[model samples]
Target: MTHVQDGGPAYWRVAIVEDHRLQRLRTEELVGRQPGLRVVRSCETLDELMAWMAGGSPQSLPHVVVLDLVVDRGRDADPAVVERLVRSGMRVLVLSAMASVPLVRAMIRAGVTGFVGKRDTEEDIVAALWAVLRRRQWITPELASVMAGDAQRPRLSDQEERALVLYASGLTLDAVAVALGVKRDTVKKYLERVKTKYADVGRPVRTKIDLNREAIRDGLMTASTVENDRR
Candidate 1:
């Protein structure tokens, strides 16, 4: 277990968090090939990773966690654990094929530093990580296309997005405030803005579920057109 002291030659301690076994292995292979990265863990879920962390396991709990959005059996990552990782000084890079525009917006609001699609080639994934390690935000071109799909897409503001994901993912406003590093009143204000935005569309956005369904139906994300972005 190599402890990467803060001032090294940009080498990274990385963990791959994907539910699929094959995908996890592939990610590990790609990370292994990259010059400055060490693949310390290849975990199948947040639970396993957390358990390893609890055991004081030194080979994992890396500086960078490459995450997949969907968990097995449709389980999602725990918002609390996500916050713990970020607060405990881990950088999270979402490496998912299931990223909708709303999801991407949500993650950004949650303070994720990087978002890369699983459809990307190994080289692209590596480059994305490099960008994040250098303290730059990186979103895969596919996700960029999702943003471009709706010229009038009234997506959530960063604050609103965080609030919405937390709300949609079953967190109370207070919990959202804690997770987002914001205040409860701030969460309320964002919710108010959310209501206003949806009201403009002749419907109200009362829950995260509503926003996600609408975002998909409106082609804001469903028509992501990843090929267009890569080309």
Candidate 2:
């Protein structure tokens, strides 16, 4: 949770992991220009960054990591990666276009130091990094309010979230399996896990109708979906 400052270097070493090529380059330039902050690496994926770290240099250690919350179009970066960075004594600051409440909550639960929306101003983005380096939690007002309002919402895994969205959108188990490239029984287990999590959080979803209702309430369903087909 803490960034080791003393005896490290003259400036803070930062690593950027973003999916978009242009954004990654821009961020690397931005962070490198800041006083007392140096961008050690700008990687397109967490795996790439991990590979760089594995190559091993005394300077390979990063004091802070800025990662896109979801990469490759709605696919969330594994929370286990976040935990690994935090345990290695790196402060993680999420920089993303923003995603669903459940996914964002899942990342927060994984021990992120801050979250910043892509639409935010450059100054605020820099501010978030400094705040995170100072061992303080930073989040945009909009995200903070959203998280606070849904503070009791259950954190769903990537597969569980996908299952909820698909099933709640009127897809049958077989159809969901096809979309997810998994077996029908695998899709069913995903739904079952989602239901258990929801129940654990005091929102019991005992039927498809109930699942649809909960999905809508959690912003997983689009506004056009006012009602699911009763068939």
Best by TM-score: 1
- For all predictions, the C-alpha RMSD in Å is 9.0, 11.0
31-83: candidate 1 lDDT, tens digit per residue: 88776689877888877777877876554458788888778664666644776
Model 1: how far is 60 from its true place, Å?
A: 5.6
lDDT of each: 0.71, 0.79
Task: Give me the runs in candidate 1 sitting further than 4 Å from their true place.
Answer: 1-10, 57-60, 99-101, 154-231
Candidate 2: which stretches are off by over 4 Å? 1-8, 73-75, 150-231
Worst 10 residues of 1 by lDDT: 220-229
Model 2 residue-pair collision total: 0
Q: Give lDDT: candidate 1, residue 104.
A: 57
* TM-score quality measure for candidate 1: 0.62
lDDT of 2: 0.79
